[model samples]
Target: MNSFEKDWRFTRNSGKGFESAELDDSSWEKIDIPHDWAIAGPFSPDHDSEVIVDDPIEHTRKVFSHPGCTGGLPHVGKGFYRKHFELNLKPEQSARVEFDGIMSHAEVYCNGRYVGGRPYGYSSFALDLTPFVKNGTNLLAVSAENPPGASRWYPGAGIYRHARLIVAGRIHIAYCGIRVRTEGNRVTVRTEIENPSARKVVLTTRLIDPDGNEIASCQTSGDRLFHCEFIPDEVRRWQPGNPVLYKIVSILGDERHETGFGFRDLTFDSRKGFFINGIPMKFQGVCLHHDLGLAGAAVDRDITRHRLNQLASIGCNAIRTAHNPPDPELLDLCDELGFLVICEAFDEWKRPKTPRGYNLLFEEWSERDLRDMIRRDANHPSVIMWSIGNEIPEQYYPEGPEMTRRLCGICHEEDPSRPVTAGLNNVDDSITGGLFDAIDVKGFNYKPYIYARYHAAFPDAPIYSSESASTVSSRGEYSDRLFEESGRKDNLQVDSFDLCCADSATIPDHEFKGQDDNPFVMGEFVWTGFDYLGEPTPYHREWVRSSFFGIFDLCGIPKDRAWLYRSRWSKQPTLHLMPHWNWQGFEGKEIPVQCYSSFKTVELFVNGISMGSRTRNPKKLLGAYRHVWSRVPYSPGELKAVALDEKGKALAETSVFTAGAPEQLQIDCERCGNMVFAVVSVTDRNGNLCPHASERIDIESNGKILAVDAGDPGSAKPFPLPYVNAFHGKCAAWIRNPGKTLILAKAVLNGKTVQTEITAEA
Candidate 1:
């Protein structure tokens, strides 16, 4: 039997009272293990007393427009939580405490010796309290305090993640860490079990196939070092489109733990793009922060899955867990759902921050934190890379390089199987001083044009735009400035004037534009996937419920850009249109027009009169058109468009647009291609894409049914066929044609079909 098992105690603590005081069962609040204090009770409008509580309209207006204040009510601090558990340990067993995550800072005591304290909000840390823990009737005390100046961006106070008391033998298997090395079809699995006990013991490791079948197993014995290996004939490789994973289960006596690992190799060939298991695949991924919408720091498995499903719907294949190690649930969800992930560590460099920076360096706590994250998440096949930090001290810290080196070294030391990386905002500094050499792979945050520059500087280093913006407008303005201006400057020159000017000038616009004009860039994660609450913007007065940059709203509603992304990423047939209303001059003319569709052609009608028919663009797979009527038509009536296929089958239709007066319908096509598109701008006296007085153009097309492909929106290659049909139609046929294959034949109208000689070629 293990020696550590005797000292284990599992009891709940009421996270109330001051840090110095001991918490008893009576003082503890009886709450579930996984809970979010911010989302605990009703969203009371009365709670606004703590911040600024005024008129609802005024509050909403100000919250959306301003920064520093998220118009929503602030979270009430000083909460309590408690859970109960039973431990049965033998004489030889020793005990340790493990917590998946705790928000802000926490002080833990096992039977009153003050086991340890942790401040980092995102990462997990464990404490050894074998000396203080008793066999029976032991009380575990934890005091969780919300920092005074904690981020207003929804930092849920108290113990938001899972907590457990691990009672195991001294020679027990450590938290499962599985590594698979593959050479072509041949693969080898290496399993490590940490034996902290004085006595030697045998540890058995088994590989569980996807079908719950044990493919292989091996055994080794030792108190400090135990290793095992296995080779399988049929190995499954994990990829975005084809995600396959095998479970690695390590058993020590009756205590068994399992982790899923993908046995695939990932490498980047500069000329050919990224390759997973020797097959070239694009990194169509997105950057995701830790928050789960309004749920705050709480780890919600369902919510996480919902977000992943939403991302998958838009064809996102990869996920960068931005700035910090997300809840373990997220990694597990990624593994199960088959999305590639970049597991991240911290938001800042060296130390954490004034509120709590990376101050816990060289301490036992730091080691425990790093070890917990790595060992717990090591087996997840979705995690392709382990990021050490995000935008860490590029220009401010003199010891930036040293700090990076130390972090990289620590990450490698903990888990050598995965490559270590840090998100860099300043690629110029990284390339010039060789500061990025410490990392196995270099990651740039905002720069898209530096791919060649980095390749030229470090010929052998593997690099990626870790945090490229989906669109310049999505990241605001200065983002482009940072990318463009930094490249223009001489590598050796360090001019603060130019840098300052560039930084100040680049401000992101909130308006949505299609994809940016950069294909050389491998992949880009839109700043966020879901609208996370707590991030305050100067635009919204109430605590902005979610980040404006997300493609989806907090309620998981798809924004206009999401459809745009779907149209670009997935090869599914689609049609989308934006209605224009509230133009300046035209206010009294009935321009009743309908956009009608079959499977391939779209028919437009004005004032109940057939106008014209347009064929879908075979190459671009998109179409747009407009129809106008004069003063003879009654002012302000429904204008619609319907789309159809070659057989004149109705595919989809558009919403009604009331036209007023004699207004000009102006069309603007952003990209010129085979896809027929028109941005209908309704102008009164003058012409513009009027926000209020404008009506959107309807689109219709037919070909084949398309499935939604998951991938990164910014850098995702345009699908051969469009995927999003915006006319609220469920089924639409799409034609698949890469280039000009069939020659133009003839037009068929009404009952009359006109025929012309056409040549069909591959």
Candidate 2:
């Protein structure tokens, strides 16, 4: 029997057998684990996009109002989860209940007594329920409350992760940690096994090659300590370009466990950069957050694999699981797909606390959280670094050096194979140097200017622009303008490009745009790879919002920036076209248009109506273009541009553009403001803009007359002055006002008239 079946009983009431009274079930909703409670609740619409405001105070207020900001257990009101399991525990069998993750806070009760509470959302915790559980029925109740202290970013609540009832033998291996160190052909494999049971047991360890061939095996008799070593004629080193992994499987009687192992020696030499497998390898990576688009907090392995595939296609061989530990599936995928991973622990420097309506830092909780994270994810071979925190508030704690050191110590003690690092936002000399002693690597967030100062201070320390962006900074706050401004101003007294480049002349041949420092400066993890959901505000919604940090949209559509990354990273011959219009303007004859494609050979055609084709010109074919031409025409209908590869296989096609006279415009108006808008644009049968169009707009309402002005025929402008009253009932605007006291008429765009008959209060 499994651990859960051996220790716990099956019961009907979630609150039964616990120390406290059963929670009220009236407001409780029955739900499954790995669920996002926000999707089930009625959060405001503003909780769906990024916040664009500048003021920090206003940003805080807006952040708190979103569902993702609400902390505590999954408290979108009150929710309860209860499960009953029948367990027949043998005399020597042991059982424990493990929750892989719970959002913010959770109160777990096993058979009535309070088992424990977890505050850190991403870390996993387990409870030994052997004592409390009975033979027949076990009642497990979980009360989750979503507090109002969470961040505006999406924190899908409830048991938004996995839950497993584990069962083991009395002398089973509780935890196993393997640390591999290599010097030349001699490899040292340090293994630590914790046997909580009192009895003694024998364990066998085997190192298997990639093809499942046993390279080495060792048998040790002990429940508490097990050490092994292996030496082979040829060692396969794992690196970014050529990732080779080996498997180490441990067998304890009938139970078996396996973990991937990479035989690589890593060193951080200030002069040579980071070296893996004794060879310098730049980390060409991207930072990825946990949330996955509109899918909320659900763990869809296929979706994650698809995203990783996309990242791989773009030449990103490494990923930094930013801010927190990602789903186990992500690590597994990385192991299988051969990508380097930096598993992160926390977002804040300290444990997040809710005191007086604000989220505060709890130091003790922070240490515990770090301990839990390191202990949990220490086995993944793909993980090379243990990132403690991400962009924490440095000003809050002046002794940031000490705090970082302590965190690093905790990580090292737990798992020393991986280096400890944090994503530092403040690149000031003091802050960077303060963390230098603690951090194994110097990781800067959007601070390419400080690289030189850091290298100058500690020339031997491995430095990297942990996070960098060409257009916008992470968190969607700063833009590319900030980088340029700092790059141009010699006031900083540094060579911006020299300090920022991730690659150098000594490295492989690559492009060197002004202020473009990558690979040479080690490497940079772009802000994000995919658009995530939540963090909605009024400004960011109603359009393509959701952090705007990713290169791809929520629907998996590659944004323009994605192309830029591809061009820089992949350097593969490619073609991308963005027409002035969508597939909405095509008639019998081809119309004059512009086409953008990054290809050696290009041909333009509208619905099989071939225009002209271009061969490799290096400059013209690869750049954006606008050309006037007439070609084979199509019947009055929609038109689409299609691009073909050298093999003539269609690479991409645009949406069909409709050909015909454009639809008439529709408009609406209110008392405070006169409004005019068009639902559709007027176009010729060939989808070209119609010529010679004019419209008159007028606004009339019961309120006092406001100033009026006509808008350009080209622009869909609102009525002059008051369109909708700031504080009043609805009003109207028409194409032409008929001076009737009861009727208000205003001229609108697209040659439309809006008339509203109203009765004024007497």
Candidate 3:
């Protein structure tokens, strides 16, 4: 597998004999396996060229006229990946191939024979390779077809996740077939094994904690399925901010394998919000897409860990994989980091959100897709709920209720330990009235106005905010107007501190109050936690191609709005100052100074002079809390904010100064194994980040550059290169095996080159 991932023959153009055993692939280019052929493309506006006609399949989707044309990137075609490997297994042993995820449609071939295939990209599937394999060298081929206009956002092409090959005895534990549950001190495990020989076998399962202590052991005899129960002396339950995991090793006829599991109980009520282990807890959640900025859809362990750490720093305790299932590594990270997850299955069900979406194949493939998702992720402890669909238009149709019920039933039958839910956006009570009976939990998307009415209609239903807060803003841009609707072309979004909604349908300021006052409303998952690659909102022809709904920008830099959530969710005393003190046009006139803090009193100062102090007024804020000094005179100096407790003691203090012209290039690199992530930032002479700097920098490295990313979804610049224009004063570049002993990065900004080195270890 290591050598197969290192080098592979890839061709974007398909042919009839490409999957044959004797076909010649010598002319194909050598590339890596976890690659997005579409992402590494010659990007242009012409690529977003999907047209909607009057036909049944084409008429259901919407048209676009934005800069990127709404396709996001040039990943709308077919490609092939062929690799050679040696499989030396006994005739009685079996071999199989497992794919975490593929793009849209994927087919597999071994040696020369055709194997099984999977159509949906988000659902993980497997194929048996024993029948088609030889004892020694064998050729493996895979073809991926991703037609344009199939999705509303950018879905990367080809195999964008981890792939592995498993070889075991005739009877062995199946992939992702173990489910564990804990009730007080008792641990129950259900294991399913595959036995093509139809022979009964004895299976032994043992539970080992992180400290290498064996807590329980049991054995069972079965040909296909078995259940084992045991009791431990002490139990530590998994909860928010405290994640405890255990390893389960299964032995079936000499076959050995292990998986990570945890013990926790999740319950919900209309009157008590959410509970974990009998303690009430709020869901501080954020919706996240699968793409990792410039890294595309490929799953990198360090990259995912870095993103989760950033979200955790901002006080987020849960994540909602918006509209689709996520990479398996993401769920693993949530388990290790103590984040609850709502694993979603599909974005569209029977109704097309685009010209060619999942609806075109829903009837034939939905059941298999949903079942596969549950089987693959049922073992993860971080998953508390399985979301069937998101804002499906079926909610308004006559058959919507039955469709929802069928989907929920499938989820429950597959794994009943977790409840099933769907995101309903229909604001009409009559239309969505029957959906409550189909699901155990009701997820409302962008319909906060109907909370009271729906609660009265169904007193037993548990309510959750599947998606909320579509506030739009660009990093470092400021406008004095409280709200702006003209996010049209040529209008860059307001400053990171100012939030504006697209229409009057939602006032984010008022929604927070509604959630806090109603016990029936458990918690809200914001529309986005980070800016994703596509579906540019408040879009205009002249604007960039990505979204502006994230609390943090694409580069993982926190916008001022992040402090708004941190003030309310974080337990630590926090104080933050926004809109750096650099306003050239309005230097003397009154400037609006705002501070997001949890403390009761906040004092404002400008250049060592005290402006005034004010206490937080609950009646003044509708959304999150913030202290506003609306009429402070601006100057070219330092601005500071200090937060004090009720006893007048200082809790925390923060300061922001007017940055000078960009003078230096700073590099912060994190090395995980052979991978290196070099975060490049433009800074002033004093080392403070210059948010306004947009300098074109030339990067020359002594090692391999994986991808150079700036988090600007609108930019058509080629990545995996040596040069990029910093967007909002920041960009990132991923390097592989910089050096066996040392890695060097040299950046040239404004004709000055600075070099940095990282001491690497094996």
Best by TM-score: 3
Residue 437 C-alpha lDDT in model 2: 63
Tens digits of per-residue lDDT for model 3 on 1-762?
345476778998756777887888888988876777777656665665445332222235455455453435678878888988898988679999888888868989998679988888877888888889999889989998887778777788888887888888767788777777667767788888888987889999999987778878888887898898878777788887889988888888778878787878888888778999888888889999887766777777777888788788878899999878888889999999999999999999898877678998899999988888888888888999999898887877778888888998999898877899888777463245576578888888877767888888777889988888778777666654344453433454544554465443344555676686676788888878887767566653443556777887766666777888887788877787776676778878877777878788988889989888889666776323677777788888889988877887877889988888777777877675566767778888898777766677665556577778666656767776666877767777777773553445455555676655554454
Under the 3 Å rule for N, CA and C atoms, how many clashes does model 1 have? 107
Ranking 1 against 3 by TM-score, winner: 3
Tell me the tens digit of each residue's lDDT in model 1 across 316-365. 78888876678888888788787888888766544444243345432445
Best by lDDT: 3
The local lDDT score (0 to 100) that residue 123 gets in candidate 2 is 70
Q: Rank the candidates by lDDT, best first.
A: 3, 2, 1
Locate the minimum summed-lDDT window of 10 residues in model 2.
503-512
- Better model by TM-score: candidate 2 vs candidate 3: 3
Candidate 2 overall Cα lDDT vs. reference?
0.53
